[model samples]
Target: MKEHFKVTQRMKRGVRIAGLALAFTVCGAMAWPGGTSRLIRKADQAFELEDYKAALKLYASAVEAEPSSPEANYKLGITYVQLNMPKEARAALQRAIDLDAKVEQKLLLPLAEANHLEHNFSAAKAYYEQEKRSAPTLEKTYQELLRKRIAECQAGEDLMRLPAIYNVSNVGSAINSEYSDYVPVLMPDDKAMLFTTRRPDKGRKSLDANGAEQIRITRMQQGNWQESELFLETQQQMPQHAVVSVAPHGKELYTFFADKGLHVSYKLQSGDWTQPELLKAPFNQGSREPSLFVTDDGKFAFFSSDRTGGYGGLDLYVSYKKEDGSWSEALNLGPEVNTPYDEDAPFVDTATNTLYFSSRGHNTMGGYDIFRSSISNATWSKARNLGYPVNSAADDLYFTLSSDRSTAYISSDRPGGAGEKDIYRILFH
Candidate 1:
């Protein structure tokens, strides 16, 4: 699971240098509120150890105590970046720049990254250029990576300019809670929607602060998704269970586990769901598998796994169902559909032979972006980003297209949402 947090070597070098620069800022003011050298030291230590959540709290305290401390705001902004929250990062970084103009030059890369992630391409490009002016002072490799970031900003700017024609809106409060609700699986019939949510579980004593993930379902009635209720048949099976794929008939469901890989549950003729059965052999390789996408007929399945032989931390793999009802050895989707970076959440449209997923590779604007690739001539084409609003600078993932392809849904932690993450619906043009 920790491997999921790993970044590329180039990014590591940039962050390391940027962090060292941030650590040395002079704290000249005395009697500043919440400002303490001790707090800064502790935050810095936590940040250096990649304990971003802890560093975020400490830095927030430092900023509260010393609102005038440019360094504190800078640290808070960068901490937010590490936490994959670019909107908050941009605000904190901007405040730091306002407090001390010099802090802008020191935090140019983070400012660029945060803005880029938030889809503010112009601001991100400007910051990248400003950082580029001083790029010669850094290592050669990092400078090259910085150039790539600048190009990424330019790409994002271009994409944002030619916006897609789609009506995007929140799915409404009735089906959403103050907590995160994501990874939706809308059945082919479109009558029921199943998803994972982090709303409080009153029965779990060892739940995390965000609450244990549980599966919930809501029905569509009179053209609106009604209020949500737990998917009782498979509820409470795992402390952190998530529904990844549902059969075309909505009678079978697939879920992932850190210890067991991917498993499935079937609804019997009595209309009660059976206990989740661990998928056989190739699908249950006993590593950290996070997502699963199966074909409607159950002939093939695509799943995300971090097991060995991957091109990146997690790569998408497909396994075919053998004649005997067993599975063939998992086959990597190859470099076209995957990259030297993590890829997850594979959704296949067998009708069009299209595959949609989220990836940290392939010309991403920032963080993870949703991408789609279709098969032609028996090979997958280059993955294309879903673009602009459907994808954001934060980790935009868990995308599901409706049966008719006229509507789509995605989960994101992007700002202006109800909580940590929210499901959004987009009506295609």
Candidate 2:
């Protein structure tokens, strides 16, 4: 094992191990058995059964028995990561990688995650990119995008605070409803506004699995927001939740799911919007927690996906928008704007050329805070929290412009709300 980064202090990590879920039986071998593999298997089983103390002891014994087995080392590394011992996990995982460069990239995925949790972005990035490059052909594309995000850290951005006196607000009953409404949009020319919401409609049937459908399109007219109206009913499906993300060229629209699902289409010459259809797999895995945005030229589409080899959780990514308007595989946003918790709900405004979204991994005051950053030539500045009143003790998510840019919209569960979560608007000076 190599000293990738000097261990400063003990690193704290989350306790979740996905692959170590199988039962380990001390199998009776045809001949004398119970070798190092068996011992490791037993230790892993003990971990699965919540017997941490027993698992630790068996792992130690396994290492003593077969001081050089990569499999044993990997298991040990993973256990340490679960227990928040980055120093031990790093040593163990590095040993596993050294022993066998051929292990499924799946193993590197966890190591990359552990490294990021330890705030060793450089090492985490190297591991993530290696995993992406070595992934099975079928998944390499997605993995590549995941790698980009893990390497996106920007130094100055993390430490700077948002400017004072834009006096952020949580638009009251005027815009929000008794449901989850987020992912706002500023209409062309900034006079009209558009946003996504879960406000109930007359007998709308597209209820999500949780029975709360996060839907789209709340408008503001004459200095007031009209109660939200569902967009393109023909494009909706039962038990599905959706949010419109980008509106390009005054007529084109981009949308993503609160859960997983993607719908894209354009308005036809007949004055009716085309029926929305599902984005294909690798791009639309009903399991991807997704977000979408398009560049000024519409040649590239920005999105977020968990995929594989990510630092952890969901990461922001991008894909090319083909001539036919179909989307390509995503590209990770890298270490600059992404972190281990999750980054999604991207709103890329080409006019002001600023990017805004919610992040849980950055220094947040609470659940999820809306962040803003400048976008310049395929690069993004560090994101700054929109702040205090606009960002509260709870989630202050999704930023929508009002009928005019003078006011903005958001959603939260803090203090006042019609239900568990409600929409609120903020006034922008």
Candidate 3:
């Protein structure tokens, strides 16, 4: 009787344990897959919202859970590309293609871009050609863009083989940071530089929260650039400024403030910038203008805007200062200078009557390339690409000349630098 009781009790205990084990197994199977699906959905949503950092983490988790998932790997690669991490993007994209060859057709162009951005021109060209061959029936516009991309790769390869003799070097950590630093405008005699930086705001704990770009000025002391300081007069409790140009004499600073249009702040007697006031009428026509240059005499202002009646995108516009000290109606720089694509960052060399800016439409190898046009007796000439190493497969914009015109500063993302967009000084021999 005792043995019988012990056997029955042991069997009951075993049954209870098995039931608990079965419950856990069933619950885990449902929760694990469902949780992974939820993560993937959230990641896709974040990516569409342009929350790349958030998407990166969530997609990484999805990839971890399902290493063989081609979709997850491909999406992660796209995120990396958007974040400007081309190496990681290339690897992830290649893995996705390996897992599913079908992804190759869908991913070839972005893969090409990744390679191009990393300065792997040969690989980029090959991928672009492959994409071309695979999609022979693509729209004519897209086909043309692809051909431009291929040409860009060829240009990059050519440039790499025989680079210009110009000695390019980082401006040092004093004027540069791990973050981007570009759009540099050097004053006469190289006395000072007012440029845009994504450096953290000194007073803010979370720099990304109100992360409007801050304008910083670096003074040249004893022939070296000193530590940069923010344009405090432009700073609010929440700073906002995108300085596009500084006058040749550095007495006037022009900024593209949101909605309020171009605001000019002149140097005050106290050695500080006066409160920025929006330029009147034609200049403040409630259009998107990203850059401008005011001649030293302040007689004419060359600006970039996408207002109606433009050829397309952002066309260059020039507004002449009237005798009454007011501005005239904005006049498009016209087809000779503007194209059916964007033309921005206009810098006028008043001494030479030359206009130098960046254009995407006029014979661009791939992306925006710096172009120069001579303004002869009030008529603009045909724009010409600055060419080769001065321009790259990546964007090469914001070209500015020093006082003597012996040296030029251009903003570019060409490889082998600190990172995204560093300013390069071209010393003309």
Candidate 4:
């Protein structure tokens, strides 16, 4: 797993870290209390970050500092669960309830999971059901997943299972195929989508039996995707061959030409694509597969390149489009975003003020998983993996989000895909 590798990497660098198998909790931004706040913050951080042992040690000091801190006590209980010490976990959870009865039901969901893992199904089911009823929109999926867990307990399934349930489903046949379909770019209205696929070929590419390239456009009328149909011949000259990336606005598309050139073709206002133009300067120099993302402001372009001078590997560089519309010489994102290891799949989510990408340099739980960091401030922090189900041992990269910021689509080579790679959606709660 990428995470296991990361822990090993950190340890070799003299950072003592515990591997907490890809467990994640949805969190909201909270205010920093500041100062020796460091001790408690570190403890709370270790707990939230899935490092139970360190969290346990730090929480002890946190409790001593503020004996009446209900939050600290509640976190202590959660850390116990992570450490897989049931008796201690139970006692701490009960102590939390005694100190803050409000957590009795709210935090009980995690408590139930701990109990369930410890073979206390009755308690888990009771708590899980109680928590399930607490949220309306979440009830259905929670109930289903709970049923699966409860069944696993009844059947005596192994506690440590392989290829953890991806909890995945296709975006529907509307977006899938018997042929390879990938690199989806959902337009702002979420109504139109332009994706590249290799189907019903012009009969070229490689002689891999499935050789050919094409483009398909689908309109979202009402609420669902209308039937996907191929593009007109005017836009098909280049055959939409090897679409590596697309800008957020769907106004431009980038691809690798069979002639050993990279083209940045413009989509015209009348729904026609103009003659493909050869990209110069910053882009044309990169390797065959180019990464692209047009930032919201429209002038800055973020992409990956292995141009002559880079920190190392395939570094991500940002180019500023001049007033004359020519892109300036690419500037490396520096070693901060780039690494000795290859980093690709550049995506900008300014809604969260973050840049999401994939890297092998950072501690990973598996092969090439998505990691994101805030760009709102001057200095960007280390990137955090989006974590399991959405990411696995298989390569997971190239993501696009709906403009409203509620849903996202990520490309992966994980099994069950229509082909080598398929796009999966993540609807956040």
Candidate 5:
């Protein structure tokens, strides 16, 4: 998936909307006799258009012009939330509450959301409770969302109490940039890696100009990763392609195309990739199949799809290669692995028969969290959360492990990342 997709998913799962009508009313209530009103109106317009970056700047100016205005501070805080800056959002939202107690009715849910993103679970639950009391007439759907959020906070608290003992670090500037860099796929030997990045085109001034997801490859030389280079072969194939998983032997690569289905490309003897071929029939039956992983022996393929007959949303499914080299009909991984919510980004460790994937359900602190299930006696075990450091209060996906299992890589949007989503290295301890 592209970086924009990740942001959209996060916004859908976490961010709350106050609606443009409420925003207009709030700005109008705080309208000054002069320039502040103009600024507020401009900020509201940007926010309404979903140009949050522009809205962020205008809202900041509004706050600077009126430090004690609850409306300005509240709008600024909401803009921060849209931008995924939880700490800044918490500060601005708290300021709004301090400026006027009445704003608490409008600000509590977003404040709780900010705290939830920061992993301050206890405070988030308190604010959620306060919001529930303040808004007794909230719509039934929204009330259910609040209940789910509170439960997630409890899950976060429980998970944080027994944090994973691992050192998680950014892969650094060699492969990461100010733009989204994620979906890391490592070679079997760990000497090279392939990942997708959403950076500006070579001659473009900024990502907004004409940015697109481009695959990049980096190789380890003398024990340090060399700077990445764009994988032009794959880039030339399509405007939108996501690196899914590399074949265990590194001879074949899997990718997803938006209009097409899952694809595979082979490494030629001369070291160049052949044009990718879309998987046929039963494999591409779904309207949307975002991920796939082939077993080391190449007998079984695991993927995720939202096609009919699924447990719900996107469910993990498996297909076995038939005698004629065609895939069998896809079968859901059963209710234990497929929830009513989405499950995606499957990565299988063939050696252990363990399936690692991200899901919107199952003990998630918030958003998607990585979970693993192993097959034993032909039954998939109940999925287990990978726990704190590897799984945060954000969408974590595309987990890949080194051959020795001492190290791993994952893409996440947790705080302190260089961009919306960055590939992180996890050193098991």
Candidate 6:
């Protein structure tokens, strides 16, 4: 998943931020001092607006001003969760519970989630079970979701016992910055790569501005990746462009535009790319279609969409190229591969006819985890989680492989990362 689009959804789904009125009620009941009360109110406003950085600062001040305030600590903890700082969230949330046992009713789930994200599966499972036994009145759907989360924590516990054989490492400063660098699309030969970065451009003050998500390209020189440069051709006209997939031979590029849908650009013989052309019907027919994978033979294409009639949120679908050079109607990958939660960022290895994607359902430890299912006799096998450290408690998606399969790339916000989401290189042993 692209960090910009999916992170917000993941945070909202996991934490379910409360309203400003609730914060005020808690503050009013506690009778917080004047200065701390003002800070909490302003912090709640920033948090509601999704300005997490600003909210984090304000919440921290509120906590400092009134160390014993359960409401301030609870808000601070949730803000840390939004910023992907699970360790800090764990500290603040645990402190809130210590200060006021009643705050546990409000923060128990987030506390469990913080522990899950920190890879403390056993502790998280205990907390989740406690919530289940205590909250007998939770809505039916939410109860079902809680059961899934508890199962996921159990899965995390079991999967940790059998870690996969892979050496995962950061892609380094050449391709990563303190902002976000993700959705890496490597050229077939492995000499060049294309990716999306949320790093602010020159003269830009904030990532929230237009054109913040820009496509960049870098090439290997002397056994190291050269510093990246903006793919100027993509930025010349569009304010937002994300590279979805690159043709096997690197002659064509598939990109997504906010207003124009999926587009394809061809590389001319003169070493320049043509203006991207929007793909016609049967593609991009929904509110969101963010990822794509085309086979080397160009006979089939797999993509993710949230269009109507899907089993739930986003589901994977496939379309075949017709004899006349048009795409056929899409066929859903079906219930075996998709669940009530989102499935996205499809990639295929034609050699084995395996489909790889990220999903919020299945046995995900917390957020999205990569899974693989192969086609046999025209049916996709049950999806299998790739396991840690290729996947962590944090969201991990956009898994891409080198032609030889010796190395792969994925985007994740796992702990110790250089930024919000950084591209990681996984070497299969």
Best-matching candidate per TM-score: 6
Error of 5 at 168 (Å): 1.5
Better structure of 1 and 4 per TM-score: 1
Error of 2 at 172 (Å): 4.0
Using all chains and alpha carbons, the TM-scores for the candidates as numbered come to 0.83, 0.56, 0.81, 0.57, 0.87, 0.89
- Per-residue accuracy of model 1 over 97-177 as CA lDDT, tens digit each: 898776666777777777776777888788778877876675454565667667666767766877677887889886677
Could you arrange the candidates by TM-score from highest to lowest? Answer: 6, 5, 1, 3, 4, 2
lDDT, candidate 5, 308-329, per-residue tens: 9887778899999899989898
Off by over 4 Å in 2: 1-163, 189-210, 214-216, 257-260, 285-287, 323-326, 376-378, 401-405
Better of 2 and 3 by lDDT: 3
Q: What is the clash count for each candidate, in the order shown?
A: 5, 10, 0, 8, 0, 0
Give the winner by lDDT: 6
Taking all chains together, the TM-score of candidate 2 against the true structure is: 0.56
| Clashing pairs for predicted structure model 6, backbone only | none
Q: Supply candidate 5's per-residue lDDT for 186.
A: 88
Clashing pairs in 1: 33-65, 33-66, 34-65, 35-65, 117-393
Against the true structure, candidate 3 reaches a TM-score of: 0.81
Cα deviation at 28, candidate 3, in Å, is 26
Better of 4 and 5 by TM-score: 5
Sort order, lDDT high to low: 6, 5, 1, 3, 4, 2
RMSD of each: 4.7, 13.7, 15.2, 19.3, 4.5, 4.4
> Which portions of model 3 miss their true places by more than 4 Å?
1-42, 57-67, 119-126, 132-141, 154-163, 202-210, 237-239
Give the distance in Å from residue 71's predicted Cα in candidate 4 to where it truly belongs. 60
Q: Which stretches of model 1 miss by more than 4 angstroms?
A: 1-65, 79-88, 98-102, 129-148, 205-209
